[model samples]
Target: MSLKRRSFLKGAAGGGAALATAAVVSAPAQARPNKVMPPQAVGLLYDSTLCVGCKACVAGCKEANDLPVDVSTPDALWDTPLDIGPKTFNVIKVYAEGTADTKDQEKNGFAFIKKSCMHCVDPSCVSVCPVTAMTKHPQTGIVEYNADACIGCRYCVASCPFGVPQSEFDTPTPKIMKCEMCKHRQAEGKIPMCAEVCPTGATIFGPIPALTEEINRRKAMKAGEANVFERRVIGSGDTHERPAAKYLDHVYGEKEVAGTQFRHMSAVSFTKLGYPELREQSYSSQSEGIQHSLYQGMIAPVVVLGGLVWAAKRASHIEDEHPEE
Candidate 1:
């Protein structure tokens, strides 16, 4: 009887060891490469130098989305949300130094940055969602969330590098919320509300390729050079003239995490504007690559299960041969 029990224990341990080995063997040698941008992808370009911190984009987003006002002030007289939240899809943040007298200077000046969904090409939220709650449009490359499919798991909230997805914790029926780039407006032959209402052409909406060209054009311009910036849509001819500020050489979201549809140009360093520095490869690509490699065709799990079943059968035969003395 003692020998039979030992045999069963050994069989179980051997099964577990086999399972671990199979899993390790199934794993790929390297993580998957980052996904490429969609062919017809559209996106936003935010020039921090042109932004006036007026919050017009915020108001326009709320109105276009039919979102309620988010009041953070004690008086509740104005909708002055400090950052992006459930009801606030977009907001402008200011970085200040010393007297904050200058606009784009980092030493004794202040600069404004727009905060919203980055709409990553390889979205971590889309990869982490257990249900198909978060999805990216293949054609437009817009990241969208479906409340009906959401299981309230908050995986998206945890996975987003930009902290864009916000959960409605205060409500009884909570839902995750984020920007969707005004898809409805686009269907109606209109542009994103924020871009349409931007008086300074700070935030412009257009195709990703065109926006990249525009970014390059901006980068080549000399500091204080007067330029005509397009507004609303890239080719709308609705233009505004302003002397360009000394822009940083780096363009945020161009290659970070493989790329994002929303790009930003700033005179002040992006790190100071609360943007996280990230590598070219996306988190989703690495994790999903390993997961898919292990589970492809259910090969690894089936192998492990088969080993366990064979061990269990051997243990049962041993028990039968030596009945419970």
Candidate 2:
């Protein structure tokens, strides 16, 4: 073969080999295990069965957080929020089907679901933050955001799986907003306003272990049997007696991304109450693996292109030197 022909063939072969190995080269790395919860982690136990669709918790959260009222209607008379927004940090959404007469019944009933941050053990927001603005407390496991450190990038809002973080759009200067489980109250030795004002004790706060125990106790009670539930926080003297609703075996936060501080239990399906179906694996692990693979393979294409360009240039130079008969 002529020198030019040999060079072109060699370059083509090299390019072909690079293309063939592209998939293997770009394959993501193995995913790591999800993170575990902190020992002294504090969170809330929200029982959907016990909720009465009252806006007391919602009102209390707004007051405690010093958030402005969300005027959903044109008149703007009352503080009516359709969902958690920049103006509203927490909300109670209702799931109704058929007649909706009975509470916590799927066939022909309704249920109330509390909307707020889950405070995930392996939070995506904390992982994706460019600055250390979004942080998960090591001891308490509470996720907090510092607007001063934030550049209003909105990466936290996009990374969150539960759609908890929200950016204010109405004002010129916007900040990300989410529920921090009333951590400010904790400093003052007070519980979350939402939990304190919960008339049915639907929302209770305390250490995760104690809350888990309370959840187990409620699950053990037979359906339609009376059980006394503690109010505000676990070990709180305030209590209320009510018939236990049939609960699902699965706990919402328990095994989801290696668990979350805020846990939930419900007689109705979580999907029916607007909660998304999620796998136990953390999304960060999967994303990081993909990122690593891409980083490794980024130079492959450049090398292949360089070889092709060099071969073309050499062929052109030889053609000019040796004129065709």
Model 2: lDDT of residue 136: 92
Task: List model 2 lDDT by residue over 141-242, tens digit each.
Answer: 999999899999899899888899999998889999999888999889999898999988999999999998998898899999998988999998899899
Cα miss at 253, model 1 (Å)? Answer: 1.1
Best by lDDT: 1
User: Candidate 2, clashing residue pairs?
Assistant: none
Backbone clash pairs in model 1 (N, Cα, C under 3 Å; residues 3+ apart or in different chains), count: 0
Give the C-alpha miss distance for residue 309 in model 1, angstroms: 4.3
For all candidates, what are the clash counts?
A: 0, 0
For model 1, how does the per-residue alpha-carbon lDDT over 1-325 read when each residue is reduced to its tens digit? 3555678687888799878877776756367889889989999999999999888999999999999989998899988889998989999999999999999989999999999999999999999999989999999999999999999999999999999999998898999989999999999989899999999989999999999999999999899889998888899998878888899999999999999999999999999999999999999999998788878888898889888988777877767777864
Instruction: For model 1, give the 10-residue run with minimal summed lDDT.
Output: 1-10
What's the CA error at residue 24 for candidate 1, in Å?
A: 4.3
RMSD (Å) per prediction = 2.8, 4.8
CA deviation > 4 Å runs, candidate 1: 1-12, 27-29, 309-325
